[model samples]
Target chain A: MTGGARRADPKPMDVDALIDDPGTKIVVCCGAGGVGKTTTAAALALRAAERGRRTVVITVDPARRLAQSMGLEELDNTPRPVPLPRPVTAGGGSRDGQAARVSGDGQDGQDGQGSLHAMMLDMKRTFDEVVREHADPERARQILANPFYQTLSTSFSGTQEYMAMEKLGQLRQSGEWDLIVVDTPPSRSALDFLDAPKRLGRFLDGRLIRFLGPAGSGTFRLLGAGMNMVGSVVGKIVGTRFLNDLRSFVAAFDTVFGGFQERAERTYRLLRAPGTAFVVVAVPDSDAMREASFFVKRLAEDAMPLAGLVVNRTHPLPTGPGADLSAEWASTAADTLADTHPLAVAALRSHAERVRRRERELWLLERMTSTHPDTRVTEVAARPEDVHDLVGLREIGSALAGDER
Target chain B: MTGKGGTGKTTAATALALALATGGGRVLLMEVEGRQGVASLLGSAPLPYEERVMLSAPGGGSVSVLAADAEAALLEYLEMFYGMRRAGQALTKLGAVDFATTIAPGLRDVLLTGKATEAVRRREGGRRSPGGPHQYDAVVMDAPPTGRIGRFLNVNSEVAGLARMGPIHEHAERAMSVIRSDQARVHFVTLLEEMPAQETRDGIAEVEALGLRPGAVLVNMVGPRLLEGVELTAAAIGELDEVALIDGLRVVGATDPTGLAADLAGEVRSYALRHLLELRVRGELEDVGRPLVELPRLEGGMDRAALTGLARRLSEQGVRK
Candidate 1:
């Protein structure tokens, strides 16, 4: 798909079949902000579970609506089972990932046999967990209590990306569910999720860090003899106390640094693996489509598995026997009809506006498709209300699967 | 000002800058995120740390823009506080500047705030040469998104790790005072949608929690309120007639009136939903207790001219005053 003569149009992404396939273990919903990415991930996960796949959704979006939609008061770092829609809410089954995987036997009147678990990525908490799990108590305490470490753990620039990758790897290794759906973090650039681990790893192993690592490790340290001069130069400028503190923090973090590189590499390989499919969600606006195309091009460059595009809140053109009325004609007519019929006048005005907007959206989408000719796209029309409940999600799911509008 | 991702805060901030500068007062519009949002919004080249003229407002004033880089901020800080250029250069060599700005997000925010609020508090020109002419009458920053607005502005928290006495700590505390003082107001920009409205409510609370008063809520991209209080509820239930609309379009010389009718019917449904959603969002902003400014959705997709129109609207709405 990345390198070839492209078809006139890409295949529509089949969400249900993708989930049902045992080979597809990881589904990453990534896109620009305000493009309904969180909603797409939640709906896809919900649909997957209902279709008899033991699915767990891990969303890094800071928005709390995912929990709200599932009727859970909140979701933290740990995965919480969302209550099923069945009337027998007091425990009609579905406890573990295993028992929840029920076969199809017509036992699905209201609720599906599959299970859905969700967790909000708490980056600091995940970092804390990683430190606690990786280091001995004394070492972990020393590292965590360091002022620099405290700042880095809580508000470091690439921390969210690194921790999200860490969490994804943790979930994959936990062997809990058959399929896992991951939502990209709220970072403006969707590629941040992909670039974070490596960036974090580099910072960990970078020149300053190596200069600050234990003096004893200098025998093998590649900075080679000028390290002390560089260190002293920094120490002289920042004051010896601050440099000493930073050095100590780096020394304490050295053990975790190598582990970080390893974990990042593992996750990077996992992302490039065959089982992973990236679903880029976007609204039909020009900026959104441009970002979506950027994402497509980046994923292609990285050789990540591209599973087509999911265009959300798309404005479909008016379709009937003959839906070819030009917006200019509608505008002229609306202007003429404005005096007597206010409601119809307003309606015509809106018709003209909608037609113009839909045309722009199609023009942009075509521009995107022209660049990547074989890119598959599924268009989901906008919902009047926010999808706050499972029914709304199911409607979205049906829309995603082409079963409903 | 800040709001949720994709809430058009950058555009609003630019317009606000233009509006504030319309009275012959120079305004500095700073963007800290390196998103180049202000540059694109103003149709200027990518802004460096140096202040450059972006636009001259219609009335009389001018707006200057700056993408406040952390490194340049730290250098500026050093030059102003310590009077040592060599030490700043040395630190930059050690990657400490990069580490402080990009590596430590909180510290980077402190630098961003320290620089911007410094400009805000400046008396036209340098305080040393007091009353000659002001650098800017006001400073408007296109801050981080609503989710991190609190953290970005919380200089006290950023200083908490620095043991109470260092220059960095002192700088943070001073920045905190300026930010929390009556001199500063953190405005919010949001859309008339559920997520953005909810985020705006929470964001206002967060700003207040940081001991800062919230500013106006600039609601962007608002569509026309064609359906009134009771009309929306009626429209949502499919009561708006499609056939009559089709006949009216035919009578008015529209080609293919049936398709236009279908489009109008669908549009009415969408508009009704938006109306209902917008009504609830208005209530949410009201609960935030800040004055609200409603900017209409631009007709031809908010080009530079339309952005100027929005600035004029904001000025009319008394946003600058």
Candidate 2:
């Protein structure tokens, strides 16, 4: 896997087994944007609960209907219970097996039923909460009122990812859920999710921040004596008024709260823990697969537990009666019969297109698998409609679990 | 152009550039995300920090692409505005440059938008004279996704409360004037799906709230309607004249038409369902009250030829420079 040794066939990712194992405490689905990471997280959490685990899903930005499906109307940074779709049949075949397997876990008194909760990350509220929790009311109010703090809390690039990390740590510490499915923010690059916390941490603990801290602070007193040139230069560049505001913001923030880097480090270690698994979600496109490969390599380099890759929205291989017909033959036949039988021509044309698309998709998948042959892989067929409800999520879950195509 | 992540914003921006480059229009295609998506799509080497001619369009016009880096842009901004290249280098050594450009909440966006708007306002013959001809006929930016576009473009408001009078604030003001003017139009590219369409609508509203003009809604990757109206209805019901299809397949000299007919019918059913959903989304997009330009889903995938085809389609749809 390190040197790109190709595997004849990539191992299949067993999502069910990973979720069913109580040892897997955290499952983080991360990948490029619009690759169905959020839906995958929701579906994984739902499936984990259905299979008898106390599960909670933290989605960064879900579609309205998806949020509604999880019984979350607003992003209040609080988890709400999602009523599990009733079992298909009481004490049915698989239900009995599920209950028997999950009977030993008495964390919740629902007997055979597992519980699920979901929450969307409100980054601003989460950041504000951190301030209020760390500082006294007056200082908290002042910090919240600071224009720089408002900008950082509301529109900062890394705030969402940082807050997501904060919320995940909070959830994990609360011991409310046995399995936490975390959906990374839809950053421009998937690496943003992994890099943001560290970036924010670095910024927080950086020399510039220390230099800009209140004059009485340790670093400021130690270095400010010799850094007047730097301060004046920065002041000239950004204006004295703005610099003062930033200094005060930093001062207040420092006096009340510290060690953002420590929290980020703790979460990084938690992510590296064996109990955590990273599922890189992608689609069968060149850009997304390429991003997925980057993520896979990064996860490996970081010593994180790489569960597998979930290739969503993939076109399944062409199968059934016309399976043997090559695309060229179908296309040529369709072209020849174009004037006479429009219906048959349409059918043939579609079959040719489907065959060709599946071929290309498989080629893309092969490129990914060849790069990381040891990584487990799963493919979910592209759904015609967006997943809008619990049932849609369940269908996706089954597809993810390899229960169906 | 901004859209939901992974909705082919770069592709659409490239196609738009190619389309604008026709008829001797000099087009500058800019990608701010640092993905080099334009370079990859054009099959060119990685784009350098400086602008370079990436493609020559059909009508003797060309597209010069710049993969804008915020750090480089900040250095350029300092040198151009304050003649502080030495000071900039010093700040870089002290890590304050990185702090200001990268970690400073709104300053990075200020630099990015400043660079882009400067390009827009740049005059020919390396002069800033108002009467001089413009450098490029048009400029297209592959901006951040919809979630961040408003903040990325509304730099003045972002810094209005922070830096009230410094060069940063002045540059933000200049950039915002250019961004909010009639010359700048924030087009949205989206897929004909629920999430992307919804996001496009919300993005349009958000930009409007910031007083930026909303441009056309470029719908990317719209699938074709393969089945006829009646056939689609029947397919949706899972009863798509299968016997007739089998007969037709037999007439087309198929050795085994039964399985082929059934498989094709299944495909038609799925297609019909998807097409209906697309129609619903299109209807929703129409309610946003912006011009809609639909680009077809290329059969294989996006390549140079497919991109050219898309450019031709955009031209045919009357998308002008």
What interface root-mean-square deviation (Å) does model 2 yield? 1.7
The CA-based lDDT of model 1 is what?
A: 0.76
Point out where model 1 deviates above 4 Å: A1-11, A84-113, A213-247, B43-45, B75-94, B123-127, B242-247, B253-263
Which parts of model 2 have CA positions greater than 4 angstroms off?
A1-7, A87-112, A216-226
**List of chain A TM-scores, every candidate:** 0.87, 0.90
Residue pairs that clash (backbone atoms under 3 angstroms), model 1: B124-B134, B124-B135, B125-B134
Q: Write the per-residue lDDT of candidate 1 for residues A255-282, one digit (tens) a residue.
A: 7556566778888898999889999988
User: Would you give me the overall lDDT of model 2?
Assistant: 0.84
Q: Give the TM-score, chain B only, in order for the candidates.
A: 0.93, 0.96
lDDT top scorer? 2
- The residue-level lDDT of candidate 2 at A166 comes to 89
Q: Candidate 2's residue-wise lDDT over B28-147, tens digit each? A: 999998888988887788889988888888979999999998999988877887787887886787678777776676788888888899899998877647789999999999999998
Q: Across residues B206-276, which tens digit of lDDT does each residue of candidate 1 receive?
A: 88877888989989888776767555677777787677777787798666677757767777877787778
What DockQ does candidate 1 have relative to the true complex?
0.38
